[model samples]
Target: MVMTQGWIKDNVQEGTPIKVARIYMKNATLAGDDLFIDNLFIGSDYDNYIRTSLPATPNGNFVYDVEVSKIDLGFDINFMAANCGHDFPLLGIKDATVLSGSAEPYSDIVVYGHPDFTAGTNMAVGRIVAATKPVTGSFELELNGKLVTVAADATAKKMKELVETNLDTGIVLVNQYGTCAGYAWDVEWASKGGNQPLIKVWCVV
Candidate 1:
């Protein structure tokens, strides 16, 4: 279990947006049951403000206040939970190509998207897979019909020159990784008796 609290200082004006500076939790356990957060008070001054019961979702009530006016304001978040059978997963993990570079005038790149599900449907899912290959040789830069010498570790400068000298010039990064793709599924059905909806969702690696 972890208990934490912190404060945030921000500048704003009346009638402006007021961003939430912080959210404090008295007790947070990874292996806890479904938790509910309530009694949230957010505003610039104690006299005039708004209050409500927050949603009981992971990372849901973390941000409570924002710039309501063009003035600086502050608020406090209070919540509690119990130990049960609920756990959160870790995010931000990528083992594939992570490309980042300057965009060219007309170049094509691959993009991906996730699936959308219907409300009260019980389940929703999506998947994406990619593969790459490698090559080794003396890479060269050409201007007009002649090969030009480009300094090592000057990929950016060389690329800019290529684009300027030849409006149709381009740069490409090549590598080899195995093929990767998978399928996902989500299904939900109302349970018999008085039980809630039974839901199942999964993805293949």
Candidate 2:
């Protein structure tokens, strides 16, 4: 028999409005009644006896403390960020169109999503799929094996200028849409694109 202890830190703060929508395991396997779980308790305290102090052994069961926090709200969290505090480096800029292309020369530009709410969900791994400048001054991205392109516009130009001017340092994130638009992508520079320099955005599918 194998016995183990587990603990999970929930993000529902002291005053965050929430509800236990449902309780169900995503996956499970049972054979000959091999696995049995009982005395499962989920609450702020142990047995309502200690309100502030968490008991090391709740109901005679050894407990394990697990560190977990929400990296960002309204986005599908991966295993790392959901269980640990590790967060992926996400590139965020305003009024920018993220695109996708291959590393080869003159690759076909793949455009996905519009500047505002047209592309779709933004809860995936983003990476630099391509760096070649497809247009005058736009960025490209590869998301989920599909090429997504953000055309060079005011936003792209601004981001490029910022990145260039800041000695290639990290840029601040600006969420104008009130939530993550699911444009998980990387950053790159295309010296010859559009009216000015271009910032390429690509997703790592």
List all candidate RMSDs to the true structure: 27.4, 24.3
Q: How does residue 157 of candidate 2 score in lDDT?
A: 40
TM-score quality measure for candidate 1: 0.15
lDDT of 1 at 146: 46
lDDT of 1 at 3: 19
Candidate 2 residue lDDT tens string, 143-197: 2333444443324344444454543333433221111111222344345244423
lDDT tens string, model 1, 93-135?
Answer: 1332213321221222322222332332221111111112111
What lDDT does model 2 reach? 0.36
Return the lDDT, model 1, position 75: 23
- Clashes per prediction? 28, 24
Q: Give all TM-scores, in the order shown.
A: 0.15, 0.16
Please report, as a residue range, the 10-residue window in candidate 2 with the lowest summed lDDT: 174-183
Task: Give the Cα lDDT of each candidate.
Answer: 0.30, 0.36
